[model samples]
Target chain A: MDWQIIVDSIPALLEGMGLTVQLTLISLVAGFFLAIPLGVMRLSSNVLLSSPVLGYVFFFRGTPLLVQIFLIYYGSGQFRPVLQEWGLWEFFREAYFCALLTLILNTAAYTTEIFRGGIQAVPHGEVEAARACGMSGFTLYRRIILPKALRLALPAYSNEVVFLFQSTSLVSIITLMDLTGVARVIVARTFDVYEIYITAGLMYLVVTYGILWVFRTVEFRLSGHLRDRALDPVEALKLHP
Target chain B: MFDLKGYGWMLWEGLSITIMVGFLSLLLAMAMGLIGAWGKLSRNKAANLTATTYTTVIRGIPELLLLLIIFYGTPTLIQNTAERMGFDIRLDFNPFIAGILTLGFIYGAFATEVFRGAFLAIPKGQGEAAYAMGMSRMLAFRRILLPQMWRFALPGLGNVWMVLIKATALVSVIGLEELMRKSYIAMGAIKLPFTLFFAAAMMYLAITAVSMLGQRYIERWANRGIRRA
Candidate 1:
């Protein structure tokens, strides 16, 4: 309830917000690119192509992200000598790199599934129509299927983005000075845990709402011609009554 | 290249704690979900608004941040309020209790949506038919609505449960000595982070795999007598 404490802490918390936003943006971009091929592999008929992707998705989604973060950050240390020999120790040594790597891998798993769902959801008839027009292989996928799948994937992908943003908070545990980490530090120093946490929570709320707004705008733009202009009276009745 | 000798008991104990917390929180979340769904569906504006706000705020923030707030901030707030009331008392949170409460409350928001959607999927005519048969609202709900809602809610709730199980790991960060904490301890002691955490990950995957089997059974049970697409 102390307004002054929250106000005074804004500058410090905003600094942490920078790192949080950076982590989310970088991982989401990297994960998005990596997930495309993985998603395609996930839908393949060949066991060789599909099973590994399945296992990757299962492992990442099955375990806690915190555990994954710990495994990558600390577990990498156990292989320090091997990592050094391979010249990868330098990348693994920095907490920032470790956090970024974990985020990218984790998000890639979830995004792969989302993309696969979207791809599968592409209409069968439309695909056939494209084939009837003699469109085949890469051109068919590029010109027709991929665009629709991306559109279909937008809502779920946005949810993943929100979840990913919230998850960046976990990097604070690895000693990254993200928003949550800075909040913890401030609370420890000032013993004003509630106020500081509330402030941080509000900052998160603002960011999340902002993300929602962007997704809404994107959905609105992409949904043209697909969305019903008028609500169905029967459906409305069923919902309300 | 590490050994787990003499650490079997510790790991088992941690697994038990993880299951314990997961079970208790699942129960709490189900209870919250029921109440939350009722509130949202009720005719009262206050009830609807309260449910809406609860789901919105909880879903917006990070679960880890919420866990920390509940674990560290609640007791301090309570003690300070008690002092202001001229009562000298100290309050402390049991990490187990705090973990269950926070996780349950957080997941409850998600459960609310699941239950709400499930309830809505049930046709209004079924309840109306019961009422026309001289059945009271409570009886009508019990005999007509609950079973079907369970059927519709099962898959969504199953996904929530899977996430909830993994979320128990967050409680370890609050010092609850769950599976993740045990792995951390073993890793620190043995200097074998790779082995310990890999084992922990395997244990989690094992639990999730078993849960998937259970979910498939429930889904089959729920879908019985219903036509499929």
Candidate 2:
């Protein structure tokens, strides 16, 4: 009901959005790059390679992201001496670094499973055709496997993106001034709880739909060939094998 | 290290509350999911609109944001509105109650889709057959449709459960004495943050692993006598 309070808090909340956006993007992009190789490696017959990746994905997926964030941020402080000796303390010491690392690793683990499923979902006949053309190793994956798999992974990846964006709120518990943290601080300052929260929730709603819109557009483009395009029933039957 | 610096007992207690909250929320979610699915599948435009809006709004926001709003914002709004109407009253919610309701309401949106899919997966002929056998509508739904719907709904419901259990951790933010909160308290007390959090993480993983096993067992039972393609 108090418009003035929400109006006054806009600057701080917008500033907090910067960190929220940064955290989501950094985590998602890093997770995507790491997941590509991990996805391929997971399907390999070599137990030594696949098992570790399997364990990594299992551990991260099985546990909550909050625990992962706390473990990295607060838990790492317990090993300050060792980190200090290895020159890694500088990176682990900051809350932002710990939060970012946690987000990246958590997303990477989940995305690996999605990407692996995508790879497996890639048609067996397509792989066979690629092999018949002597496309092996890098050529096979790059030219045939990865492309189709990435398309298959898009919808799941979009879900992950929404989850990751929302999960970024967990970083606020670690003292980062992200959007949720900013809203929390304002609510504590001005007792207009509904106004502040409603504002933040609206902002989140807008961003969520925006992300979905982008994904929908991309999905349509990627899978366009699979959809029918106004062909007559008899003509469509003729095109079918 | 896993002794949790002698604070293991507290973790055990917290785990009990966490599981309690998880199940209670699951119960509420299933109830809402069923109602929402009914509204969605019904021919009434108003019911369909209401169901769509509920799922859309909840899915758009983060669970923590919704939990915080319900825990802190709801009572304030109620008090404000009461004052404007010339009534003086106070309302406060226990964090436990707030958490269960918020999570139930949030995940219910997801469960709505799952239930709707399950309902649609059943062939219309099954219900028609029930009616032809002189069964009432309610009896047909209860005896014929519901059991078959479960078989279709299991996998999606399992996914919802996994997310729900993990989501109960967010209740710690509202000061609920769940596993995550207890671990935080112990971390502050013993200063062995790594050991305490790692133990909590392992406990959570154990719960999820056990849930997965139970899910698989139930999946087998629910799917008994059905052939897979």
Candidate 3:
């Protein structure tokens, strides 16, 4: 490994880190909101609303993120005339926005399912007791249901967040100069693929490790009220970015 | 507003290759997953560490990076090793093999967790009871452990299978004629990216729906005894 070359490229690579964090943070925030309604629909008794949501989750989860990105970026481009007429062309024209939209929708579909599991895991007795206390509708969901589901869902949600962070690298293909993109650009110039890639890999390791640390601290704080705490540092690292 | 007039045959061709790659890699991933699960669960510390590292590194590295490394770096590495050993061989990697290896490596990491969880779910006393009945270790594992583990692992394994099926699309970046690559070609040829890509997405949805049905049947079969009870 050429240590000097890696040292020289850090500034350029760090520039791409902005895009990486941007994609991850935006998608995570968007996906969390999107997942709530979609998750409720997935568990809904009504088939009309639920089925479409089910189909959406199936479609997104079943296809690769790369294909979805291609479909959104290239596929949307083919509909330029229609998009222009509808005044939506501006949104699709920006690769960064399109990539963000894809990641948001894709992660939302998966997180919806995860959250659905969490919602279902919420004990029925707790809901009934809350209802007996006269809570209903949004009040019921906001106070009684959402809090319990979040607690149940935190572990899986943490993993999803890490996966989303790692997945931001895919945006590089669509012309967003993320970390991976910068590394590739450096490789094309320097022709030293291994050193540059190792640098990128190490960068990911650091980011992922940081994510793992945050999750552990949060998990530890969350379990502070519980009787038995079983958060293993090593196991917690697996959930890191 | 959709035009499917001229690209019918080409779409079918692309779908076939996509299915081919997905199935081939599915088989390879399953085999690797089994071996990886064993390696992870073995008593040997080195085996456990190797499996853990393999899963962690492979999972952390983006699929595109792995494809790029194998495609560009593997050949160079092979050529250099050959030169140093006084061999006049210029080694070439098959794209299909590379695709399978990459997918297997990715899915094997997930399968290790599924299989480990399943093995842990099985009560240890069952294995002890089997041994007390004069059964060999292998036989005890085959009869007492494997069946129950499979049942417990089916749901998790199913999720991994779904993940692997989707991940196969990444292999198209390496110039493979899987559905995504084929759709790209058709889109390029006709200048209608939406139609071709939509058709490709539908094909993927069809495959996904079918596999889900397959998973349902496997789950049913695995739980047959429990259902009867």
Candidate with more favorable, higher DockQ: 1 or 2: 1
* Real contacts recovered, all predictions: 0.76, 0.81, 0.52
lDDT values for all models: 0.90, 0.90, 0.81
Selected candidate, larger TM-score, 2 vs 3: 2
Question: Over the stretch A1-241, how does candidate 1's per-residue lDDT look in tens digits?
Answer: 6789889999999999999999999999999999988998899899999999999999999999988999899999989999999999999999999999999999999999999999999999999999999999889888998889988898789889999999999999999999999999999999898999988998999999788778777777667776686334233222220
Which regions of candidate 2 fall more than 4 Å away from where they truly are? A229-241, B133-136
- Full candidate order by TM-score, most accurate first: 1, 2, 3
Candidate 3, residues A1-241, lDDT tens digits: the string is 5799999999999998888988899999999999998898898899998999998998898777988898899889878999999999999999987899999999999899999999999999999999999999889999989888987788788788878888888888887899989988898898777778777877886787577678778877777777266657565564232
* Prediction 2 TM-score vs. true: 0.95
Q: Backbone collision count in every prediction?
A: 0, 0, 0
Tens-place lDDT per residue, model 2, A161-195, is: 98899899889899999999999999998888989
Which pairs of residues clash in candidate 1, taking residues 3 or more apart in a chain or in different chains? none
Worst 10 residues of 2 chain A by lDDT: A232-241
TM-score of chain A of each: 0.93, 0.93, 0.95
Residue B186 shift from truth in candidate 1, angstroms = 0.9
Candidate 3, superposed: residue stretches over 4 Å from native:
A46-48, A229-241, B83-89, B133-136, B142-144, B227-229
Candidate closest to the true structure, highest TM-score? 1
Candidate 1 lDDT score at position A7: 90
CAPRI accuracy category, model 2: medium
